[model samples]
Target: MSTVHHLDPEQGSLGSQGSVDLPVDCGQARLLELGYKQELTRRLGPMTSFSLSLSAMCFFSFFGGLPTAYVYGGPVAAVWGWVAASLANILVGLSMAEIASSYPVAGGPYFWCLELTRNNKKYTLIAWITGWLNVLGQFATTGTLGYITVKHLGVMWMLANGHVFSNAETFLAYAICLLLAGLVSSVPAKRIQQFAVFSAITLVFGGIIIMILLPLCAPKLQPATWVFSSFFAWEKEEQGIPTDAWLFLLGMLASQLVFIGFESPSQFAEETRKADRTVPKAILWSIIACGILGGALVLVLLFCIQDRDNLLTGEAQGYAAAQIFYDVFKGRFGNGAGGIVLLAIPLLSFFNATVISMGTNARMLWSFSRDRGVPLYKVWVVVSKRTATPLNATWAMTALAFFLGLPILFSPSTFLAMGSISFAGLYISYTVPIALRMVMGKSFPQGPFKLGMPQPVINVGAIIYMIVSVIVMLLPTQLPVDSNNMNYTCVTVGAVMILVMGAWYLPYWGAKNWYIPKRHLQPADLPKPPARTLRAKHGGASNGASPSGSRAASVKTMPSTGSLPRVPSLDSQASPPYPSVRHPLHRSTSDDGSEMSVYQPRLQLPDIWKQPTPPRLQRREEPERLPVLREAPGKGPMVPPHD
Candidate 1:
């Protein structure tokens, strides 16, 4: 049996101690085999992937959400509900990881959808729908994070100055936060990523500090029974929770939302080496890491609740988490100094997660735009020559995120309540492809990181979980649903889907003409295959064939949409190897005038196609031999018959 190889961080690949079976840069080769050339540097390992996922987890969301749990089902939901949500997320992550391992492409969700449905003619329409789901999901996520960042800043100001920040002031602050996040994302520097990693480190350590301090600083700890079995019954009738079960589901949203974005790491597929293995591992472990810590943190918080009375009555200065922190610190130390320092951790988490998420979003957008599925595709697809980044796509993503937050200014809670919109978009994006993959029944290639026998179970379970989560999130948080407390998820998510349909059928101007990406092997099903051969004898060109009896000259006719022709092996014995083809230049007119690009099938060959025939293969002159005179008497006449 072969031993598992550890990742070599510097080289960005797995290093086996024993004899190797695969060739160098096999991941890169596989990517080409999948029909796209590797453009991003494949230097990320499992650790980086984990960092990305962990960074996107947003510790602030967990803290803010804990109160929601307490108000609904108290310590019981905060503790057990977290466990259920984590398990559900793991199932979702497992399903996502399975596909990510197989495809290992940027913007994997919709790409997987396109590939899984390749046999169907309506794949374009399906992919178009899934693509917007991913885009809108990512936009809502960034918007949510940005809006929350403003809320955090507002809370800090209120605590320090005893003045509430106005909605307009909050709007201006929100704009600046998003703009900064966007600009930072567009910079296209590798070093910028390290800052994000640092932010993740801060979150982990901050959680540790909070965990250690919560019990030590508490006036007294609750009994094991209270921590595990007891539920806080809220007397407020306006909450309108009909039953404990309903409240429990509502309370679980924080855990569910915090866990949802773990799939974001799959967007880093191109950048991670051994991506089939590394990315999936990254995705699974990231959630596990967050879950483990989040669970412990929840336990500590539940056991250390000093005053539930202060919590139910006061608004906690408009932040539920702050009361918990301040109350614990004030009880032991006579001041909330420790709590003040702890509050700042989420700020670091905010900065870290915002950049990490936006980067993921930009990469995904860039990949989609590369397929010409996005509007202004030419602009979004361009890579900045100097920075080697998809800056245009980054800026475009940032702009949409900015606009998505516009509703926040008018009614701050609208955007917050509409948080379910993010969940709907993200979970829906995940559900369709996984469901399709299941229905498609294993025709597509499997990657190294498969779930084996449990794959079917995992995929289906994930679908159920996500569908249920979306439906739950779209439901009203409280029963007395009014305009102020209503959930807008149904309207927003439906509206987005309707827009996608309209775009697809919008007469001549719609996405009917949008480029539908085909599989690397798909064009083989076409009338004239991409890789055709000419079996000519000895010397010259066959009818309608190149003079060399090979495809070197006909390379010009290969369409950009198809995969590169099957390259002949140099050492093959079946036939002499064909000479290589160069990347010939072509000019295409765009809004930005004429730009030269390497004509596709996108392969780079060593030998030039425009070379003279090699001497060995040249035709040889032969001495004319007279046809044997079968008729002995007519031998002389047979020679004179020629004019």
Candidate 2:
């Protein structure tokens, strides 16, 4: 029905690339309608969105989790537990994706909370809490990834010398990683985009290389009976879990940890092209694809488990998963060098995850500060003019992550500790806005992406899945819950929420009175785009020409009763005003000259309004020619000359 768009300055014979005019960024106007102007560049192409999200989802994390899954529930738990976790996260991803597509803002869940709560000034409490949760969750994720990177680095040290790192060494290694990720994240988003592509390829191909080559190159594979049904039993009495059923539930952590960061894509939405459509696809599909790939990866690692009895006893320098990769290549190739080299693939992928996670978290922090939700809002809200990245926020989160890992020097079980809260914080934050939307009746303005009839069902399912996951994440993996082995999810996330509440009610400076970002949250009252009024610019003017028409046509001045000579219209002359802009201020002369208005002008709209500044007033040479007389009602806005 509509094919008359894209004005051209050149002919087709000169170019097959088509229109030479600069293309409009897809969601810029929509963002203006959302209240805040676009502060970030829409530089991320389609490939970067998907890859960046996948990298955050951590496809390479399967190798790291393999050891834990095998120790508790063996091959069966490692393979199928991941499959079950994938299905659960996919539901959550879909629900979040629908909302992400609708909003496509950088604040992600917290901004959504503000809107779904009806955007009133008092209701910003929901957004405040949600933003704090997301930031804490992201910090936890960065810590977890840092430990994993050190673990991978430990694998290299183990292959060369023979033992895992001491607590001090682990801290030192993680510090190096923190500094590196912070430095990388400080670069412009454009360069970080290239790293995303590399990381995604490494993760997908790294899994493929291991799954295909390790199995074929191994001396032998574990039987189907063992791979599908076996359970490597730990000391059930010591742990007090008492049954394989409970242990399998415990092993679900292996997969759920890898699935938690799919929301990263939505954090990058403001910087992505056609964000309304692209971000939702990135959020949803990144999980579905990563889950399937990770399941295959864990399945392959299970079949290649050559030493079941000694695997738990740190036979391969205390890294149980690295032992499987070493034995496979050592059996066939007479050296573990190939295995070590290949293992670096996933390790580097985790490094990429670290950088990207820091980047997304900075964006969320910047957005939260923009709404005055965080302390020193002015400091964090500043974006770098040179790189256009949130450098201040990036460095702040990176420094805080260094502290989160400091606990590792005191506690041995850094993985189980940070892992618990990482998943819990993200899952709980994700649940809030989805629940608020459901309470609002789920009937809002649809964006480029919407679930239609299935939306409500998916929303409910995501909420349930997240709530259950939060509970599971809080459960202690070990029985004798002490300082070292306890699941600190409750303590860490609970303390964070209390601090958030303190900021909320802190007298005059609190967010309670000031947080009002989602002013247009209620769908019924959301601002609509203004209708176009000028329509005489197209054929009347060529390229680089001013719009044609009586810019004074709509001037609000005193009207006269006489009919003026008919003027030429752009429409009759095959001219149409540019659809994207309003009429500008100018004066036009007719064949039979007469003033646009008899008396002086009364009101003038400003140019900033697009509004097209009001037509200029004319001053007579003698200063007596113009009159101040008012015209009668129901008359055309023109005057007859008194010659």
Candidate 3:
């Protein structure tokens, strides 16, 4: 029933004059319970949040990378590998949902880490590292999405025209794609949400269309046994790795990549309505949707393969899915019809993926900068007045992604190496907070939406899965790794870790002062106004006055209690009626040069933690009094004024 007054940052004021009532629900109340006030507009409902997360994951885009699994471990790796990775990722999503419910902030993992660590210095350091790592991961993911979209475009071009595009042309295309995605991200939040929803619908129906059309059009199809039961065994000499088992494990990267960005909902927590409940549901549901849809797509693609040797060694040597599309539709229908479908569906999905990725990156950067977690925090934290979005962070991230993608022009291997760090960085960032939560054990505060009794077990499993994923990502993809084909993900990850750690220790960085203030972690640090006061001040109709009336403008008086209501602590177990602390009496020189003892009330932890309520005022029942008319000096007396 409480009215929430949203802050207009650009105008440096609270509420809009003559604005309608905006109820403050438990979700927003939880945000206030934390240190931050609601800055971003909560326009995203549960469906929009789910669509955003699903778009970021972009399972349909996973088709672009399916060839990696096929090459590494053949049919079984591409099929079953997806199933295994999806299950592990579900665990990760669940663990993050539990934390996201407790601390539903745009700061995401960083804020959760701060809450989990409390005031402990060592754990605080861990929280700082988590924030930087998360920022890096987001940047890397953005770059990767941009790279993939551009790569897909280049492949599509080669497929249509029968010519391989050079790396320079691909880089130019990458820049253009990044620009387009940036533009999409800079739109208003509602528009962005709409775009996400549209993209998700297109992806789902497009996937279904592909699933149906490919199976129906194929002149010859692989037998059920080959599609579901058969495993394409590989000799040690034929695989990239030394052993078949290692190769299969390496092939799991394809599925792992699809699940990498499922944490997108948590990053958009501030923008999502009813974030505590909605965000967790979105996270869990998106994973389930992606797993089911992605698994089906993989199975369809696998079954529709009519010629394995042609897919692996012929004109479609590197791109099997593209080959399947060309062979199935083009062979049955006309070449033009098949080409149109290929460009329309998967290519469009890639474009949507890039835009969503860029948006996610901007949000993470803005959240991090809001806490002074990044250098040049002032510039990045500026939200646009026009779009009500983080335009600066959006463009900055686009520029960073552009630069990160520049290495592609030099060598595809180098670009792949750098881009691969995103997978490792994201998993590592996810692991840290979950690990801390497990360490905190019973002391950790459970949010409204939680895993109940199985949280600890799930946390342990998620940590283990993340650790394995990180290791797999770091391992070299090819045997006898040389400069040309070596995986530099480990080197990149190590360098980033060193840089972040070194910056924290360096005096010039001043991380100790700005990283994460201990006060921000305390619930009492932020105190909200009473519900009635907020309604009146914000000009809400619920206050029983016209929004523009003088009654709405006038401030209501509180009872003469001589003390303010206590602010509530996050700990529900804390007893009510918190006691106040008194400061020691200090002797001060008075104006007459006499010493006087001055005493002041101090805010103790318990006092600040207590929940505050508005004091009820009794209405006066006396009859209205008439105003007395005053006569001007040396003039006739005036008539009395009526009440």
The global C-alpha lDDT for each of the candidates, from Candidate 1 onward, is 0.70, 0.71, 0.74
Model 1 stretches astray by more than 4 angstroms: 1-23, 232-238, 518-643
Ten consecutive residues with minimal summed lDDT in candidate 1? 525-534
- Tens digit per residue, CA lDDT, model 3, 1-643: 2223344433222344444221234455466556555567777888888988888888865676777887777778888898998888889899999889888888788888888877466667787888888877887888888777776667677766777878889888888988899999999987998998998998889889888888888878787777665555463475356777778788788889988677888888888877888998899999999999999999988888867878856555477777777777766775634744555687788788888888888888898887667878889988888888899999998998889888888887788777776888778889988998898888877777778798888998999988988888888877778976677888998988898888888886557645654333243323323222311244455445434653323334433223232333333321222222223222444333434332222434444445545433355468998777898888889877556
Model 2 off-target regions past 4 Å?
Answer: 1-23, 232-235, 242-244, 414-419, 479-485, 507-509, 518-643
List model 2 lDDT by residue over 1-643, tens digit each: 1111222212101111241211234354345446555567777867889998899988677667766677668777777888888888888888888788767788899888876765776676777788888888888788788788988888777886677688899889999999999999998777888888888888888778878988898898889899898876764566777687778877767777788678887888878877888888988888888988887877777778777776656446557778887888888989888888878877888899999899888998898887767778889989899888888999999988898887778874654465466777788899998888777774665677878888788888888877877786677777767876777777766777788898889899777777666332222222222222222332322312214644222222222222121212212212111222112122343223433211111222233223332345444345457665667788855575687
Q: Candidate 2's error at 594, in angstroms?
A: 38
Candidate 1, residues 1-643, lDDT tens digits: the string is 1122333444432334542111124454455456665566666666677888888886557776876787777778788888999888899888888888777788878888877886356667878788888888887788888877777777766665567878789888888988898877766446545655666788889789878877888898778898788775572355777776777887778678787568766787776767777888889988888889989888887788777667745535537677777778888888776776777877768767877778888888988887778888879877776666778888887888887777777877677655556778888889988998798676756777878888899988889988888887888877688987777778788788889899989988888775666433232211111222122222233223424654221112312223333432322222111212222222343222423222222333334232456556689878899767454574544443576
Models ranked on lDDT: 3, 2, 1
The best candidate by TM-score is 3
- Against the true structure, what is every candidate's RMSD? 12.1, 11.6, 13.4
What number of clashing residue pairs does each candidate have, in the order they appear? 0, 0, 6
**lDDT score for candidate 2 against the true structure:** 0.71
Scored against the true structure, residue 151 in model 3 reaches a CA lDDT of: 68
CA displacement after TM-score superposition, residue 225 of candidate 3 (Å): 1.5
TM-score of 3: 0.80
| TM-score per candidate, chains pooled | 0.78, 0.78, 0.80
